[model samples]
Target: MTSLPARLYRALALGWLASKAVVLLVNAVTFPRLHPSRPSLRPRVSLLVPARNEARALPHTLPGLLAQGADEVIVLDDESTDGTGIVAGCLGAQVIRGEPRPDGWYGKPWACQQLWRAASGDVLVFVDADVIWQPGALDAVLHGLEHTGADLLSVQPRQRPVTVGERLLTPLVDNAVLSYFPYPLIGLPQPAASMANGQVMALRRRALEEAGGFAAVRQVVLDDTEFARHLKARGRRLAVALGGPLIGVRMYASYPQSVAGYAKNVLPLHLGSRPLLLLSAVAHLAVYTLPWLVRVPGWRVLRVAGLLERVAANVISGRTRPADLLEGLLGPLTPLLALPVYARALRRTVSWKGRTYPQKAR
Candidate 1:
């Protein structure tokens, strides 16, 4: 017979697992899918790319983007020392020289602002430097926007985690979304439920201008999320979609790079609260790591729940390859791997792409 305290602990863990399972089910059923649909009225589209030290990636990505029937493809060379501008020009992208970051402005927002100013299209599409645009991706994105009548349509690119380290960390991105928040809430009039993926965001040119453009989120590290929330607060219709077969991105090449990239955003996720960050780390370990290592009562049930959640996340994100399934099986150990990322985020300053910024406080 279990002691009362042990029984209470088991009940709480089970409850947490149950709540997460419900969220996953909601996401699996309600999350929007991006598919190619021709609009009745064709809007001129501008594909915008912000490049910094991305000369190597341009060759692989630009050609596909150019193939998309856009009015123009523009690339802002964000002060890259690696001839990013030259590469974009050679690849047939209209390259714009990015200006220096203004006071209290982050690099990405500044670059995006310049791109917005230079763009001449009714539909403004922002693609990150690393995103790989698949066939019919632009058409699918336009379809989603028109069908949903969304002021801003943000699509989550299917992650291609080629490296071992990438496999270990990338699944958590989908997990963070599908596990914590129900997808339906995003369609409701709730600003707090707002979420966005900067990798592939499409907006109406007028909607963007009405929201004060990228200048509104100039200082935010997580500019995509903040901007989405900003639009939501003003009663703008927002649509979230899975990129599926149309879009993909490989964010980092190795484990060390993954760690550094994740660290830059971890603290921001917690709103820069030290106490909240520590608490989240402990909660993750308790729920995800402990069951694998400790043979406490009901550990098997907890382990099964964690595995099922991981598998569900993989399926929803279109990670059905055998290799991807294996990575999903190892998702339980990501909490242990993330401990180092949390530690790095706890530092006063974090660096990315040759720039360092002080961590924002809540």
Candidate 2:
């Protein structure tokens, strides 16, 4: 016989599944498909890469970027001790020395602020140094923006997962993003629904300035999401797409590094609300672990619930099997992994790239 709590949990799980199914259906019906043959009519674009101790990855990433037919590429080396500027410069990108970061600024935003000021192009493309662009990637993004008349176009760069830990964590991150934002609905000019990826973002210069540029979100730990919110608030049209063949990113070299990387932003996600952080952690556990818990009843029921959860998570994340299953198993543990991150975030201080920033309360 099913206990009351187990039955209640099952009921909650069913409700969650139904809600997600509706979202999936809506997304399927509304998502816009990119037409590859369409040509972009926009003016030239400037590709800006902000680098801090990214020398190891720049060599591979820069060449891929250079091959993308952008008008110019500017690399802002933000006091990197690893000779990132020299490497980027040697690869044919114009290198600029980033100004000293002000108190309210984070590393990438500080560099981006300088790059935006220096760029002369009508369109500005901010790309992380860790991303590798494929051929026609730049053109596709430009075309998508021109066709949609969107002020900003961001792409979800495909991430390369080389290790077991990466495979587990990557899907969890992707699922969290998709579940939170539901991309298809986001592009429909709604303020309440908006999302963007920091890996590769393309914005019109005028639109960026109109949205208060980087200065508006300088103090924000989650700059990408904050910028998207600001743009929506300003009524600037925005669209996002999966980067199909356009770009790829290798976020971390090892498990510990990946955990630390996520910690850097996960806490500030709550804007310092401990309750919200705890709630988020609990919700994550429910979504990722409930299927497994349901399995304790019997193999047949467990198999069915596991399959349903996997399908739901897969649709949300756009990731494949085996990997998704692995990530699902690991998702419940994210709260534990996030504990130190939340503590640091609560303390309003986080260290990244060998530099620390005191968190400013929202």
Candidate 3:
């Protein structure tokens, strides 16, 4: 009636906040800058970008990449209907026209696999086409790799939201991983505790080949997360740090684009288990939405706690748009909104870049 026991929200809320604190701490320490002075002997770096109709995005990202310390840059145009291949070539990148997607392989993994095979550098940097690297980003990436001794490192890009849909859903980007999983655990060589953002991932050539590369996760929709797990299984060290300041990606341009993307990936994030899906849906909705029911006693406390969590998460994520923060904190229907998206995602066959994968892609 009035309120679910404070026991309910307090338990999940405290756990959520505590993990956020850990995420912030780890990110603050681990996010390296382009070493004030460059290293004496940095490994030859190869920048690999997987493009699918990325003509619009390549202009923003490719120029920054070309200026990096990497010895070579390659772009795999994954059967783009647009001028992705032409654009990539004109930008001075060695453009590799992507082959048709093989059966049982996802588009991104296939393209990345192709790029990895052709790469000439000791270190392979896989950047999403949408990502725009700030100056010194490549140096910072190398710094992170050298300092951590990590075989695989993923830099979660800072989100730049131009649309309302992005502002609301992008929290799930960090919140999804950072809230449930601790960064320390993710850093360990444990298959069960692993995370990575495919947008800006780096892998040592030897380790990547040794671990079977994208071929290991050819069928996974959550390609990056699964890639990190595969590397962990091979006993390779894993490291993930903040890349918001180092790079930015506007993940979704419009509401439909945002919804469609999430629909394909979000539900399966729980491993296609309906019960876990339902449970998460209920819990998330209750925490943010139910507390807004002011008729309930002590409701303001619950509301405040939920808002604070969002604010802190936004701050840590480096999304400082006051309007976005205010809208995110005050708009408590995210989970309720998310429920239909996930449900629709579950029901529909997932399609991207003119190819379709099964609803629960293996």
Candidate 4:
């Protein structure tokens, strides 16, 4: 027999699911797509990639950018122990050695600052080494920027989670961008409504300048988020689109790598405050794990709705697979699976790609 607390939990979970479902459905109808643009006046685009020990990904990613007909493809080799510069040079990219990291500057923003200075195009595209772009993605991004009149544009790529660990965690968070935030507000005149994915960001040169540029945000971990906020602060538009078929990002290679990769970014961002973090953990557990608390077929309505909401959100976002759709129904297991990551974040030490960034408690 189901207890009183269990019954009450399911009811509350249903309400949360219903709200998220409404968000997913509403954003799907309103969010813009990035198709080809044929505007008469097109800005000159320079593709810049900041790479640190990314030799494994360069060969596959470079060709995709080269095929885009971009005016230039420049790669900043940020003191890689691997022959990243040589690999970029061999692949026909204009390779530049990134300057040493300044005392307070983070590695990525420092690399990006150098790349932006070197780029001569009116438009600058910062692509992550691991992100793969389709043949005409650049044109579509240019089109999206022009159509929305956004000073900065970012397309959250279709996340391909091949590993078992990824199938469990990836799809759930994938829904975050569209599931919670209002699509129209992202471009409106409010920093509160802005968001961006660092993997593939395109910005107008003037907009970056007016927004205080990469150097201004050099020490920040949430670089893309700050970019969106700054751009919106300058009264410039910022657009975020779903890049389903046009782009794909392979986030991690294995389960262990996935844990580290996610914890480094996720923990600090969500768990910065002790009270908020504790409240968030409990809320996540109460809602997501609520379905797991009871396994009866009759009371599975809340679980079913939660699962379907995730599936519908992913499908609407344009990154759904048949397996992932079914796998995502187990969405309730996410917060539980992510417990270790949450714990690691609290420890104040995070590692990524051979670099260690110690988190300073707020």
Q: lDDT winner among the candidates? A: 1
Worst 10 residues of 4 by lDDT: 294-303
* Candidate 2 lDDT by residue in tens digits, 228-268: 87899888988887665467678887766776687677766
lDDT of 1 by residue, 1-362 (tens): 99997788788888998999998888899898777677778799999999999999999989999999899999999999999999999989999999999899999999999999999999999999899988899989998899899999999988888878778786678888888878888877888888999999999999999988898899888889899999999899888899998898888887788888889888888977988999889977877778888876689998888777888888888889988877757746888888889999998888999999888866
Model 3, residue 106: C-alpha shift (Å): 1.5
Off by over 4 Å in 1: none
Best by TM-score: 1
- Which pairs of residues collide in candidate 3? none
* Residue 196, model 3: Cα distance from true site in angstroms: 0.7
Sort all candidates by TM-score, best to worst. Answer: 1, 4, 3, 2
Candidate 2 global CA lDDT score:
0.73
- Using lDDT, rank the candidates from best to worst: 1, 4, 3, 2
Candidate 4: tens digits of C-alpha lDDT, residues 80-120? 99999999999999999988887888878888899989999
> Model 4: residues >4 Å from true position, as ranges?
1-11, 295-299
The residue pairs found clashing in candidate 1 are none
TM-score for candidate 1, residues paired by index: 0.97
lDDT of 4: 0.79
- Per-residue lDDT, model 4, residue 227, is 67
Winner on lDDT between 2 and 4 is: 4
**Better candidate number, 1 or 2, judged by lDDT:** 1
